[model samples]
Target: MRLKNKTLATWLTFFGGPLGLHRFYLRGFGDLMGWLLPIPTALGLYGIERVQTYGQDDLWSWLLIPMLGFAIAACALMAIIYGLMTPEKWNARFNPGADPEALPGRTNWFTVVGIAVALMVGTAVLMASLAFSFQRYFEYQIEEARKISQ
Candidate 1:
């Protein structure tokens, strides 16, 4: 069995958790979600592009927004999970035969970085969601105002 570095796993999951890069690193080709996530991501992008071109009346085209929100949430959760995992548990699960003593201690640079990245990403997603909802609400208000004026 190949020994996986806990730091690397945490970082990868932080950066590419939704894309399954961390999963691929830990589980190789057997990581089905790692390979499959791109499908919806690409489709979501396509849907977004369609919405941009065709307008919001295309409700189905807006599906990409929710898909991307889900991806962001999943990545943030994975980053937190991986960063919080103890080195001993990590070694036990991913590096069974390795000497526990050889492993790094509980806190490390990677964990710090991973946690920071997760927080940043989570905040950005939350802000973007709020902005999108506000935009939609204001647009509806404007439309109602126009209807009332006419």
Candidate 2:
């Protein structure tokens, strides 16, 4: 019976955590992961891109290029963190056979799935934006280099 709320929180975090909903459930764990996770996930992806393109002489500028890449990598790390940190929340959210009377709303599985899907989709969009910014910074570096050569 007491496990019902915890189960719901777990399901919510496990499923909809990327978008930050899981933190809302547990408050402490949720907030901590929410703030910390995305930064790494985004940055990790950026770091990978940096390795791929750092060979270009003009692309190796100090703050402008590396900063963007760092941002992306941090974001990627955060995504992973987000997913990993929410396991407790997921467990709390989806104990299917639990007593409804104890926990209040039965909280249908389909609804949980929907929320998770939305969180994932939202996360994808944010990542895309991060990628776009990273690309834009590189493009700016290319343009700046071209001007210098002229």
Candidate 3:
């Protein structure tokens, strides 16, 4: 029933995306995804705790840490997508009852900033996730090969 501002949506997605705050903003609390988005974020956080407690060498860290990275990256990407949407498209999708040129859907300085932030953060997170997963996997493989060769 209320208007959904593009700037607010973009910022929320960037900041609280893992918790599905943006989804709730646009789609409301009943949105299943809004509730479920935190699962991987929580799991990834637990993975960080595991690494802290058990160290990076722990297999669980290798598996679980990537979940956090991927979740963050995905959220960042979503933020970018939301920020980049055209005013017509944004209004149509999020504020169906409003005018096509509604101010809430209009692009603004804040929206651009949010998009930039999302782009920077998302790319870094994605790269880090890929690097981490590959590095750990190769390290484990090398260890296994060394053990067999011995």
Give the C-alpha lDDT of model 1: 0.72
Candidate 1 — which residues are off by over 4 angstroms?
A: 104-106, 130-150
Index of the highest-TM-score prediction: 3
TM-score of 1: 0.75
Q: lDDT per model, in order?
A: 0.72, 0.48, 0.92
**TM-scores across all candidates?**
0.75, 0.36, 0.97
Off by over 4 Å in 2: 1-21, 27-107
Better of 1 and 3 by TM-score: 3
lDDT of 1 by residue, 3-122 (tens): 787777777887777688888898887878889877766776776787789887555554466566567667787777777787777777777778764454254876787788887887
Residue-wise lDDT of candidate 3 within 1-150, one digit each (tens)?
899999999999999999989989999889999999999999989989998998889888889889989988999999889989999999999999899999999999989999998999999999999999899999999999999999
Q: What is candidate 1's CA lDDT for residue 66?
A: 53
Q: Candidate 3: where are CA atoms >4 Å away?
A: none
Query: Residues 1-150, candidate 2, lDDT per residue (tens digit)?
Result: 234344344355444444455555446553676676455444544554665677434343322344433433333343343334343443444333544343333345544554455456556655665675577577877889999999
lDDT of 2: 0.48
Residue pairs clashing, model 1: none
Model 1 lowest lDDT segment of ten:
98-107
How many residue pairs clash in all the candidates, one count each?
A: 0, 41, 0
